[model samples]
Target: MSILLYFTIVPLGTAFLVTLLRKKKGISDLLAVLSSLYLFGLSLATAGLTKSHGVMIYKVGGWFPTIGITLVVDGLSAFLLVAINLVAFLVLIYAISYMERYTDKWKFHALFMFMLAGLNGVIISGDLFNLYVFLEIASISAYALVAFGVKPQNLEAAFKYTIMGAVASIFILLGIALLYSYTSTLNMADVAYCLSDKAKNPLLVFIWVLFLAGFGLKAALVPFHAWLPDAHSSAPSPVSAMLSGVVIKTIGIYALMRIFFNVLGVSINLLSVLMASGILSMVVGAFLAIAQNDIKRMLAYSSISQVGYIIFALGVGTPLAILGGLFHLFNHAVFKSLLFLDAGAIEYSTGERNMDKLGGLNNKLPVTGYTSLMAAMSISGIPPLAGFWSKLIIIVAAVEAGYIGYAIVAVLISIVTLVYYLKFQSFVFFGKLDAVYNKIQEVPLAMKTALVILAVICVMGGLMLTGTFRPFLEGASNVILSGTGYKQAVLGAIR
Candidate 1:
């Protein structure tokens, strides 16, 4: 079997086995960790393979393109795979100790693996219909995971998320149906080839609107962002990390980029729309986050804002802008996941998430406090951290593209990001020790190990832009800049 197939299959097979082993103590956790480790290793191997071999196309059952399902791994897919799996493996490691407080740990592992499978499937799918199927698989698993706690708030958040998610799915399906009607092909590359000659079609305009709304909602961009805060805050911390770290990027941003850049091709109008939405999300999410008392809720809102930076960078539509956007996507996944895990660690120790109620945690939970400090610094675009480089690239790209107003807003909002994260640090870690948390202690070894590892990444991730890691980011950027040439690239790889 092709290595690409393992990305989806390993998680799926593990999920099923975990379900059967639910009654066995320790076994489920062991399986979950091992599976995640394997997936991370596979993702790294795939990246190396792609770097050496270029684009790879794997057809299911020896069938030909347009007739058989295909998995295409180019630079973009490889980059996302590595980001997703790396965060996932760390999150799983955190979960091993953190989840001891909750019952039915096996079920959590099972759902998590299912979600991983869905994410991997989405990244690799070359068929539009297959992408939708994998999207649903991931979405459904996420909804269940969000409600895993079965508390009133968890249920409420999951319901709201499901309603919004179902509507988005409908919009995407409608768009796909219309595109299929026009082009008579479900294969994404073939659809791109068919659409290239019909640039002026009015139906194409309608399809674009549908896809934009659908993907925008999934990505939690501004007006479509109501569901994110509640869901991210209510879900388990590890699950929240997964949701904010990768789920939005894979199902929302990645899908939108694939459909718009590779299939419909970039246009001035589309770029403008993306830029406008991004700016709105960046400004609005920041302002809303400032008022949040819940640490997780603040982090959730910050996600919407950071994602805005990414979308805005992509909308700049220059090679540098695209590179910055992809780099930020990876950086955000790392630090944001770290931040959420920190939030979880705090809650794990003190059983409180409201910043107003928490104080002087650094004395009790030194690892969590310091690691969170690193993440907060990184997210705030402080120099020498991963976040600063990507944000700098994006702001410079905007200035170069003559979107000076957008660049200004990005800079101002970045300061806003710093303000709130500083608030988080002060409220949770720096003030007088709360009498209530006096008995609290540092989290377990597993949790500390995860936090330390992610913090180390946050510190050094910027180096990726300079040395041996440069090609990984550049390779993904090249794919996006290639635009509709993606069709030729995929077809040529197959031939």
Candidate 2:
């Protein structure tokens, strides 16, 4: 549908327009907020269309899929588009107030919208080269945003991030090139169709390794996660929310899912590797988070651990496992963003991020504190909340898949997760009111509005598994479960 074009066009157009309006105060904010809101609504509409129409393919310039750019939306892409745009809209709202602490808010808006365009493009892109291009656009924007503060530390973090990101891009590009070389086509469906006829070979195995290394680094899976803590902690909080919440998922986990499960197809060896990586990330991230005093840094590490849950669940490759993985992906986007925004609110109020230096903020920033608590509880997998249900699904799926040992590890890591979050809650919100912060106030209204909306999602997110909402997650999981049928679906749609 033509509407698919708006996903990238609106954000790209807004980025350019906002840059042109540098002289108009508040105009950039107005445009950015309105564009994001529009995109969020558009994404929801697209999700509805995906539900009604199944897979929809839009060939650019009305050309055939083999020679033209194609933007496709199936249940999976529609689900991710909704998650990505919803989070982007909320993050933009929070940024309006929080970004006032920095100069040239217009520039921030421009880069943010630019990043959003890349993210949306990556989701809808139906070819490999365009996927890499959009991935780099988002990566470059993130690199600049990380250094927006212009601090020595911020620049250092951005530099490290850029280097690591470049390395990842190279690996991904090489994988794409190899795949194209083998298949003589860059269209995802065509590539899969070609691969289906070829016998499994060592070259395909090498390509899979290249992709796993590349996307694994992007996802911040353990051992490839060196850049994440610095990048997330150094960037603005709303940016951190985007990075931890959806950016990593769209460019990293989502790409892995599409390519591994849908394109190249999964293997026993691939599943084993994914499970190992996910377990390592879970253990390492939780341990590292426990040692952090910086709130953002701790939350950054927490993102790695939570991402592990999704990756591990997906690795199990059961229907229930895929459902849990996708659900947790959505839940993480909500609660993790909420947590980071709360951290931003704390910083806005007291200019402190060290938990040791912040205490009893609940009295001063009640919305932030309680919301943080709710997010904390939910992310810790407490009962009846979003995080709990997803985690429970994962654990049950693991047991059913006969990975009892891995299931036990997941439970232990969850307890570790609870410990660190409680530590966070106790250190930042539950202690006696500090004398230094007595006069500090809550964050501005826009920031508070974002936090509350996310908190409500965390509270209600469990309903996604029931009644009307069940189809959203189920639809996405069905896409992954379809295997090579995805190629047939896309090719058939084109004909």
Candidate 3:
């Protein structure tokens, strides 16, 4: 079988096998960690293969397009695979020690692997229905994970998230059904081929609106962002990291990009709407974050703001803008996950999540404090860090695209980002020691190890924009710039 298939299979197989071995002490952790490592290695290998071979297509049962399931690995898919699997591996390692407090650790690992399988599947799916299937898999896993603690707040948050998620899924399915009715094909390439010559009819517009609402909710853009702060804050820290770091990007932003750019093809009207939505998400999310005292809740709000940067950049529709968008996506995955993990560490040590109650922790929990500082600086776009470069690229691209007003909003919102994050730093790490937390120590070795690695990435992620790693971003950008020619590219690859 093709290596690309293993991205989905490995985690799925491990999830089930781990379930069967749940009664064995340490076996579930061993298998789960090993599975994540294998998938991370496979993702790197896929990146190399994609670089060498261009786009690749894996057919199931040797069936042709329109008759069977297919998985496509392009530069974009490879880029996301590397980011997703790398973070998953690190989060799994962190979970090993962090989850010791919870019972049924095996079930957590199983669900986590299941979520990873779903994420990989979504990234590679070549058909609309298949994408939905994987999306649901990931969504279901996430809902379960959100409520895994069974706390009152967790249960309430999970119920709210599930209701909203179900509505979004219905919208997406309705959109898919309408598109299939028009084109009579489930294959994404085939659907694009059929729609290529058609005019922008009301049916097409309706389908586009359905998709925008569905994927926009999944991406947590403002107005559709009601569930995010609650859901992300309520879930376990590692699960929160996965949700914000990769889940929203995978099933939400990635799906939006693939369908709008590659399938329906970008339109001026749609791009305008996207830009408007992004701007609102940026400004509104930042403001909400500023009022939050709960550490995880604030980070959850920050995720909405950061995602806005990506969506706004994409809406600009310039090659430079797209590059900036993709880069920010990667950087956000790194630093945001770092922040969430740090939040977890803080809670793990002191049992306090409210910023007002977490004063002067730096003296007691040096590792979490320092790593949190690095992550906060990066997310605030401090120079020489990964976040600065991507945010700069995006703003520059906006100005170049003649969207100066939007650029101004972005710049101002960036200041808001800095303000809230600094508040977070000051309250959590720099103030006088709260007597209650004076004796709290650093987190476990494994959690500390994950935080350090993610912080290192935050410091070094800018290298992707430099000499050797530049092509990885450029290659992914080129795929999107290919637009509806994606149909031709996929067809050629399969042939």
The clash number for model 3 is 0
Candidate 3, residues 1-495, lDDT tens digits: the string is 288789899999999999999999888889989999999999888888888999989998789877898999999999999999999999999998999989999999999999999999999999999999999999999999999999999999999999999999999999999999999999999999999878768899899999999999999999999999999999999999999999999989999999999999998988899899989999999999999999999999999999999999989989999999999999999999999999999999988899888788888989999998998999999999999999999999999999999999999999999999999999999979978776777898999999999999999999999998898889899999999999999998887
lDDT of each: 0.95, 0.94, 0.94
Q: Look at candidate 1 and tell me the lDDT of residue 192.
A: 93
**Root-mean-square deviation of Cα positions for candidate 1 versus the true structure, in angstroms:** 0.8
lDDT of 2 by residue, 108-214 (tens): 99999999999999999999999999999999999999999999989999999999999999999999999999999999999999999998789998999999999
Instruction: Score candidate 2 by TM-score against the native.
Output: 0.99
Poorest 10 consecutive residues of model 1 by lDDT? 193-202
Residue range with the least summed lDDT across 10 consecutive positions in model 3: 434-443
Going through the candidates in order, what is the number of backbone clashes in each?
Answer: 0, 0, 0
TM-score of each: 0.99, 0.99, 0.99
* Candidate 3 stretches greater than 4 Å from native: none
Better of 1 and 3 by lDDT: 1
